[model samples]
Target: MVSVGDDAPDFTAPLADGDVGSFTLSEHLEEAPIVLAFFPAAFTGTCTTEMCTFRDQMANFEDVGATVYGISIDTPFTLNEFREQNELNFGLLSDTNREVIDAYDISMDFADLGVRNVAKRAVFVVDGSGTVTYTWVSDDPGVEPDYDEVAEAADAASE
Candidate 1:
C-alpha cells in the first residue's frame, strides 16, 4: 500500500461529471493538492453518504486549491448519473478497468454481493509534487474517513 512520502501512482481514466471526458493524474499534478477518494461502488447507501459529505465539504478543499476526485469501478455513464443525483461538484473518475485500484493496492472483494475487484474505501492526499501526504483506508465499506482530518491534510499539502 502507498504511504505518506511515497510517490502517488499516476493513472488515466474516464472523467464522469457533466460530460464524458478523460482524466490523467499526472496532468493534474502540480496544479493543486489532489484528493483521491476511492469507493466500492456508486448509488449504494454508504457510498452515497460518503460522497455527499464530500460534496458538502468541498469548500474546505477548494479554499486550499485542492482538487477532489471520487473513483469507483462503475462506468462513466453510471458515475455521471450518480454525480448529477448527488450534486457533487468534483468529478468522478471511472475505473472500470480496475487499474487505479490495483495500482493503489486498495482492491477489495465483495463475495457476498458476488462483486470482484471493487475499490476499498480509501482516501489519498497527493501534494503538488505527486507525493502522498495522507492516506486513510478502511476494510469495512461502512466506515468513512474523517473529513476534517482529510481537509487538514490537503491544507498542509497546499503549503
Candidate 2:
C-alpha cells in the first residue's frame, strides 16, 4: 500500500458510468476531495452492506465537499448490476486488471490468502492536493471499515 505521506498512486481504470467506461484517479480528484473505498468484490454480503452504507452516507461526504467512489476487482458489468441492484449513487471502478489495487498494494496474496488476485478491503481519503491523509484497512475480508472515522477525517483534511 502507498504510505501516509506519499502521494496517492494514480491510475485510470474502467468504471461503471452508464456502461463500462474509463476513469482516472488524478482526473476525478483533480480539484475535489476524493474518497476511494476499496472492497473485495461485488454481490458478496459484507461488501454489499459496506457499499450500501457508503451509499446512504454519500450525501454526508458530499456535504463536507468530498466525492466518494468505490473500487474493486469486479468488472464494470458486475459493477453495473451491483449499482442497479443496490441503487449505488457513485462510480464503481473496475480494477479487474488489478492495476489500481496493485498500485495501492492492497491486492491479496494468492498462495497464502487462498484468493488469487483479490483486493484487500481498504479506504483512502485523498485531499484536493492528491495526498492521502487517511488510510484504513480491514484485518480480514469480512470486516467493514468505520466509515464515520474516515468521513470525519476526510472532512477535516479537506478543510
TM-score of each: 0.98, 0.93
Provide backbone clash counts, one per model: 0, 0
Clashing pairs in 1: none
Model 2 per-residue lDDT tens digits across residues 1-159: 686667989899898965888888888775467888999889999999999999999888988888888999888999999999999998889998899888998877546757787788899888887888889887588899998898898788778
The TM-score of candidate 2 is 0.93
> Which pairs, if any, clash in model 2?
none
Question: Which 10-residue span in candidate 2 carries the lowest summed lDDT?
Answer: 107-116
Error of 1 at 156 (Å): 0.5
Q: Residue 76, candidate 2: how far off, in angstroms?
A: 0.5
Name the candidate that leads on TM-score.
1
